[model samples]
Target: MHVPDGFINAPVSVAAGAVAAGAVAVSLRGARRELGGTSHAEGGGERTAPLAGLVAAFIFAVQMLNFPVAAGTSGHLLGGALAAILVGPYTGVLCVSVVLLMQGILFADGGLTALGVNITVMGVVTVVVAYGLFRGLVKVLPRKRRSVTVASFAAALISVPAAACVFTAIYAIGGTTDVPVSKVLTAMVGVHVLIGIGEAVITMLTVGAVVAVRPDLVYGARGLTAPLKLRVGGELVDAEPAPVPVAARSPRAVWATGLVTALVLAGFVSFYASASPDGLEKVAADKGIDKNVEEHAAKDSPLADYGVKDISDARISGGLAGVIGVGVMVVAGTGIFWSLRRRGTTDATPTRVPESV
Candidate 1:
């Protein structure tokens, strides 16, 4: 959920900001390994590096297509579970954080001052909880493509409510309104539970589609089975690796497909999405949590509220804004990922040993 400004007092907001900063710092370091081919199949980092950016853009697009969850309440993709399964946990955190940042600064969908809280709750909490649960489930379940999808569904389903609970806890500590913590908690959790189902279905379908086409590209699918070992001269050695298909070696096809899908979702399909308030928004209004909500600092931005300023046609203006958002997100995300990938490669390089020594 995007916590707007004035929802949290200054002290607690600053504390959350520190926590978010620390989490981002750690994720940056971890993303290097994930993008450097150290954490997945051979050459996976190179392939994954490009896909990470596309994943962020896709998440941003999908978030605009909210679906009706209940009467007057809607929900959208959070993207943490999907990102972690597609890329890796560290990169997943960065992906969601980037989307949140873009939404806050450009779309005014989230509050500038509450950026830290949104990152902490939506970015950090979702990735950590979803990835952790997905990993655990993957270990206990059968090692198959279907198993991975199943795990993705379960992890995604739980992450939404988990985030809601965390937000409730944060509000309990520093809520700016006079609402009762118990009422807020009950309402938040109840609505979010319904929202989580939609999240699970979306995650399952997306992960399954990618895994069906290119299981090697999915981080969570890696190491599903131990490599076969053969005995040679009374010693065991790893079996010969299979050849990778030429298409699999190049990420261009997948990248193009993903980018096109993101463009379609945000630029065209979002027009049909539900207009009802999302779970958090509804709960906030009902529980008086918005009693102290402040106006977004970027309320006058050209792209504020996912629409272009001075554009009379609602469809054209919203579509243009969505397209712009996707473009910016992809460029920014790719730059960050590529830089991390390069740094990782450099750090992984071994110093040359002297032959004369």
Candidate 2:
């Protein structure tokens, strides 16, 4: 969940900020290896960087849809399980972080002051816990696309409550208000457990869709299925490698399709999202978690609260904001990933000397 300003004390917020900064720095370096490593181990193909970027944008778009969970509470995609399963864990962290940064600075969804808190709880914690659980589950389950889907569902389901617990712990230590720690812990985890079901369903569906089309592109599926062993007279030997795909759809096509879907979801489908408060906000209001909550610095921005400033029609204003958010997120994410991909190339490329030397 996006933590707004003044939820936690200043000291804890600053500490969380430092932790978030370090986590992001580590993710940037780790993403190079995940994006640029040898084929089959990292991304599906050479377009890994762009694919990762598109995944980030897709996460941003889907997160706008706050589907109703229970009563007046609603939940949206966290994207940690989705990204970690589709791309890689390191890149997943970077993906959610990018969304948080954009939301804080431009749309005022998350607070700039609590940016680090959001990143730490939503990005780092979710990715780590979900990915860890995913890897472990895949290890024990049957090595198949279905197994990956199941693991994704389970991991994503757990991650939401895990993040809620983490936030509760942080609040216990650094809450600005006098809300009881036990109550906050119970409410946050309970409501988010319901939210986690929504997360699991979305994660399972998305991961299953990708696995069906391009299993190779799924990072979590990599290496799960081992090469076949064949009996060669007396001793067993490795079976013949599968032929390279010839008529398979181009990655650019897949990317374009995904981008279009994101635009459609954000621009139009988001209108149906629940008007009630999300899990975190509802818990906060009911529990008085943020008595010291501060106004968002970007409250006056053109796209604050996911609506255009001057548009009179609710549908039109929200639609425009969503479209703008998708466009900006895609551009920003693509640029960052492209630059990282280039850097990875530079690092991998060997230096050549002149004949004169």
Candidate 3:
């Protein structure tokens, strides 16, 4: 749900800008820790550099295919769940940033000046809230692999409502029009609840697939123990293999899988996606706030609204757009993640106190 320009007033947007800025500041330190103390600076710098751009592009493309739920309302994958699952949380924030920047500049989706608001509402808050809850659930629940998927689903489901509530609170503080806060809250939450279900499933599936393939690579699965049955009657027993070296595994393979998944979702599957306005659009139209929407700067772009201009073949045009979007997002997301990963190292050594102290 991109909060376009003019939905929230200037003062509130600025306030959100402040909040977003503070969050990014906090995430920098958080990302450092998440990446581990700066000791073994080998693989992260390169792998994480491209992930930044990839994150942005991924979020952008995924947000396009709004799945329908109710009359006049639809929902799409927010990527908060997906990003936090695939990449670390701090990098997740950066991923959303790249998507917001590209959307505002190229897609004319969210407003340029209001980019900060979109980032705060969609990027920072979602990652912080989702990742925090995801870790907590993982801690409390049974340490089964399925638990990870279950936790991912729940985290994604709750995050959307939380985001809706946050938007309502933001609008209450800086809404441009005199719409009733309750109506906005109800509608936004109501529609987004449906969207959150979609998010949960998508997040779980994506996370599950990755975990199954590269359990060691997933940051969330770090501490969980694998089964170790003792030898019986001198017969050999099968066991889960040792964790893969993050460096040994090919980034290109991971990127290819993720990019293929994104392309399929956006390119072909999106054709059958819901054709209704999303939560924000429905609420705005219902609440009369849509009138205040300013023109998107990129409206004149040929690729505006997820279609190539004058392309008669719906499948080809839409497919090309999806492919391009996937390419952009993968490259962009990879760049962002790679950059953060570069600044970081994989070592997890604890700092020791000085003997004198």
Best by lDDT: 1
TM-score of each: 0.96, 0.94, 0.84
RMSD of each: 1.7, 2.2, 5.4
Q: What is the lDDT of residue 290 in candidate 3?
A: 76
Highest-scoring model, TM-score: 1
The best-first sequence of candidates by TM-score reads 1, 2, 3
Please give the clash total of every predicted structure, in order: 0, 0, 32
The list of candidate 1 runs beyond 4 A from truth reads: 38-43, 245-249, 353-357
Output the TM-score of candidate 1. Answer: 0.96
Ten residues in a row with the worst lDDT in model 2?
Answer: 37-46
lDDT of 2 by residue, 13-121 (tens): 9999999999999999988777766554444436677888889889988999999988989888888888887888888999999999999888998889888899999
Supply the global lDDT for candidate 2. Answer: 0.87
What are the clashing pairs of model 2? Answer: none
Error of 1 at 8 (Å): 1.0
What lDDT tens digits, residue by residue, belong to model 1 across residues 72-99? 9999998889998899999999999999
